[model samples]
Target: MTQENHQKKIITNEDLFDHISGFKLEVKKTVDDFKSEMKESTNDLSNSILRLESSVEDLRKSTLEGFDMVFKTIDDTNSELREELKNDNIILRKEMNQRFSVVDKRFTIIDDRLTVVDDRLSSIEDNMTYKHQLSPKFA
Candidate 1:
């Protein structure tokens, strides 16, 4: 009976060693799976960062282009307004000159009428002097 008990103890020790080996394999497989998952997460994070950089660059370009277009439009509007003002000024000057010419013509007509009235007054004065001289001879 002692020998049979010793043989059973030996078999139990061998089974324990087999169990420990299986556990070690399972732990190694779990560690390898964890490393793969970590690598996949790192790759995903790197890709996300790249995409963010691209989006930021695109927004910057778009903002610059929008500002350029706005400035260009303002410049074009200013030029057009300047041209319109210049044209209006020219037209006003022409109208003012024409009005001044008409006033000068009216003044010339008034001067001619005044000269005729002065000549008639002188002739009436001479006639009155001649009539007075003839009446004095009767006295």
Candidate 2:
């Protein structure tokens, strides 16, 4: 009976150890699964951040290119407008010069006609003075 009891005691100890080992294994597996999930989450977050960064960079580049295109268009338009204004200014100057030339010619013609009238009046005044002197002497 004592030998049987000793054997039973030994078996109980072995079963207790087996139960503790199973519990240890279960705890270890749970910890390992949690670590794996954390790693997956971290990787997913990193990938999302990378994609976002790439998208932001792409947007920045696209925006800069759009601004460049807009500036270039504005510069081109300004150049065209400046050229048009320059041509218009030249045409205006030519037209103004032509009009001034016509006005100058008309002024010159008027001045010549006035000079001729003045000369004729001066001659008639001299003749009237001579006639008045001669009639007084005859009377």
Q: Tens digits of per-residue lDDT for model 1 on 34-73?
A: 9999999999999999999999999999999999999999
Which pairs of residues have clashing backbones in candidate 1?
A: none
Clashes of 2: 0
What is the per-residue lDDT of model 2 for residues 13-121, given as tens digits with 9 covering 90 to 100?
6798999999999999999999999999999999999999999999999999999999999999999999999999999999999999999999999999889889889
lDDT of each: 0.88, 0.94
- Top candidate by lDDT: 2
Residue 54 in candidate 1 has what lDDT? 96
How far out, in Å, is residue 137 in model 2?
8.1
* Candidate 1 regions with alpha-carbon error over 4 angstroms: 1-24, 111-139
Off by over 4 Å in 2: 1-15, 137-139
Model 2 TM-score on a 0 to 1 scale: 0.77
Candidate 2 lDDT (Cα, whole model)?
0.94
